[model samples]
Target chain A: MRGAVRALIALGSATAVWLGLLHLLFMADLDDFFGGDSGLRPGAASLAARHVKMWSEPTLKELELKKMRQSNAEWDFMGRTFLVLALANMSLRDPGSADKYVDVIDRIIDETIKIEAEHGVYYFLMPYARERPFMAKSGRSIFVDGEIALMLAARRIVRESDEYATLLEQRLDSMVHQMKDSPVMCSESYPDECWMFCNAVGMAALRMSDVLDGTDHSEFISDWLASIKRNLVDSDTGMLISSFSVDGQAFDGPEGSSIWMVAHCLDLVDPEFARDQYCRARQELGRSVLGFGYAREWPRSWQSPADVDSGPIIPVLEMSAGSSGMAVLGAASFEDREFLLGLMTSLKFAGFPVRRDGELKFCASNQVGDAVLLYAMVQGPVWASVKRRWNEAHVSSVGWVDKSVPVAAAGEL
Target chain B: MRSDFFKLPRIDELLSPRGFLKRAAVLTVVFAVFHVAGLREMTSFLCGMAPMTGGAAKLSALMGLGYVVSYLGFIVIVPILVIASALLLVSSRIWPVKPRV
Candidate 1:
């Protein structure tokens, strides 16, 4: 009996020692993961440069191209957008090596334009696009037109390219005209379908137009702002609705998948409104625990089915791929360093294995997903430059326009 | 007769230390199966996002937690347990005592 007791004591002691050691090791690993001075570091360019070199090789390019072909064509288009935006941001951040990256970006922009012209806008859109005709004439989607125009504008801002300037102006004019014709100042990409994402893109295009042409559309911007504040924004949560009809009736409530990044884009045109939206979104949607951060697809009160926009909702936690990707933009824009780092840590550990060669391809995430991440990492400089110019002009032109009619037609007093 | 009786197999011999190691190995394999099958993704359901598809409804949250714990245990703890058990067995063997008749 005594021997048995001794044996039990010895076993218990050994178990305790092992567990204690394991706990120490686990804490150390976690500390290494979370302990960083800052979240927004300047290493994306180097990472992207490495990817560019890897992609420059014909064999690797062929392999990636083959995989993209098997998947959706939008992936192919989005890949170019991400790389171009990264390159543009890199050019501003680091001019010495900017030209090489700019050349690559220009090539992507040129190629993307060619593809859009050849295959038509339908090529990049989902199959549902064909299910119904667009409400607008010429069937141009604000989604495609706005993003493409932004890509071109970003390129031109980096280096004065006459070729892209013409394209940018044409696209901007079309978007502006579409916004003017709509009774509620909202353009539809589908039959009676308007999306917050597209609208944000349109706003971004307008902001870019203001940047490029020195023109002011403060009236038009303010009018839309008032409309959003009155009709589009959810009163309880202050988050913007994701979709609406042409007549400004809500189609979908505020969605986690869209609101966060839309808020980031909205920051360009209206910082106060954007910050308000972001703060509400963070309170309603963002979650953090045990030093990790994630977001839900919908608020607790609102229920919606899992669609392509949400992208494979994980049961129980309510994590959405789209929301998770967009959360990066929100966290970065708001300067929520802890949340950003936690999310980044989660991404590194969970969301598809990112290999060491800078070839970050998530298993569950498609090309557009990665592009959004790339955009989040490099979005600051472009918005910063635009804001700087706007601030400088504000002091000079105090009596420019009335605050009530923010949405004036381009060049209209 | 007394010596022959003493020659009988011991409990440690019957359940070899190496055999326990093998069981730990089996636990590790099972843990890996569930993890790669994306049972970890189900943990997201706890966050209130609906399941990706209908098939995920079958696994209860308790079952997922059990699988995750067991999986982590097998990968992390089992190896240490096996090593410690092996050391204990070897130590016992090195200091063997004679049974009184």
Candidate 2:
């Protein structure tokens, strides 16, 4: 009996010690591990290296994209958008690799546009997209139009591209026309579904376009923001509703999957509102325990069934892998280093990261997930460029139009 | 016949502290094998994507689940078991039990 008691005590003490050690390790300051804006981060560089290789190698790109498309066709399109944005930021952050990153960005834009041209708008959309006609007579998707335009605008911001300049304006004009036709100044991502995520992205794209070509969309952007504040704010959480109808009736409540990216995009249009939304979201959906952080797909006040966008939610913990991944963007965009550090710790602990030949990829995350993380790591420069150009424009003229360097004379990447 | 307590534990002594060490060692070896075999990449299935472009997704996911389980055991359990075994051994030495007369 005494021997058994001793053994039991040993087991108990061992467990306590192990838990204590884990706590100490996890609690250690991990700022350097996640990387900051000081220089090129190893993880980001490795991730970028893998993406550059993928864009350059069609066979490899198709293989990876095929896996994601098999699950969600939208991921195929989203992966391209996130990668393009990441590369653009990388170009701006590290000019030595600008040409290479610019080359990949242009390729992604060209291929995406070519595919849309050949396969039509429904190609990248989900099957439900074709089940009904769009509310707008134009029958276009803001999801596609906005993201593609954002990609183009991002590339041009990094390095002037006359080809992308023409393409960006055409896409923007068509998208704005569709949005203007709606009562709420919103466009559809699905048949009648006006997603806050896509509209906010559209607004950011428009803002970037104005910065680039000196076009004025301030009134339209402000009107859309007013409409959203008036109609789309969720009563319980004060977050912008995730989905709405053509007339701006809420279809879904505030969702982590949508709100994080929405907040990030809205920062370009309205920083104060964006920050408020982010703060609310951080309170409602974000969680941290034992030095790890994650985001729930929905707040307690707004429970949602796990969808493709939310990915799988771990029960009890209420952790949504999809939302937690995008939360990285929100945290990074807002410069919430404490929360970002905690999230990165959880990512390193659970994300199953693999490094091969100086290229990094997370085994628990697909291409789109990794791309989102990559974009978060290198996000600041593109948005800063837009802000800088807007400031320059304001200082020069009384309007939202800036007298910027011409495309040919715009400094090479 | 009297058996030495410190001798290699017999199969009947599987419940002893040394058994815990043996179990942990086995788990550590298994996790190492899985890691070296490149099964970590298969864990991409956790987020709902096929681990390979053309292979059977279910099979890939099963392999991924195997790696994950072993990995959890390795990271969380192996150390505890080893430490427990070590502590038990130390306690036994400090407070030796007299054999029954």
What DockQ does every candidate get? 0.09, 0.50
Residue A7 lDDT (model 1): 44
Clashing pairs in 2: none
Model 2: iRMSD? 2.4
In terms of docking quality, model 1 is: incorrect
lDDT of 2 by residue, B1-101 (tens): 56784577654254358788888998999999999998998998767677876558888888898999999889878888888988988877888866667
| lDDT, candidate 2, A1-413, per-residue tens | 66667777887888888865653454524443345543567778888789889888889998899899889899999999999999888888788889988888888899999999999999999999988999888889999999999999999999898988999999999998998888888999999999999999999999999999999898899899998999899999999999999998888899998999999998888878999999999999999877788899898998778889888788999999999999999998888887888788778777888788999889999999999999998888888789767766663454433223343323222
The best candidate by DockQ is 2
| C-alpha lDDT of candidate 2 relative to the true structure | 0.86
Q: Output the TM-score of candidate 2.
A: 0.90
Candidate 1: where are CA atoms >4 Å away?
A1-47, A54-72, A357-364, A399-413, B1-24, B27-101
How many residue pairs of model 2 clash at the backbone? 0
Candidate 1 chain A minimal-lDDT segment of 10 residues: A28-37
Indicate the DockQ of the complex predicted as candidate 1.
0.09
The iRMS of the candidates, in order, is 9.1, 2.4
lDDT per model vs. reference: 0.66, 0.86
Tens digit per residue, CA lDDT, model 1, A349-391: 3453334553444433444565566666766666666665565
List runs of model 2 lying over 4 Å from the truth. Answer: A1-9, A23-39, A395-413, B1-16, B91-101
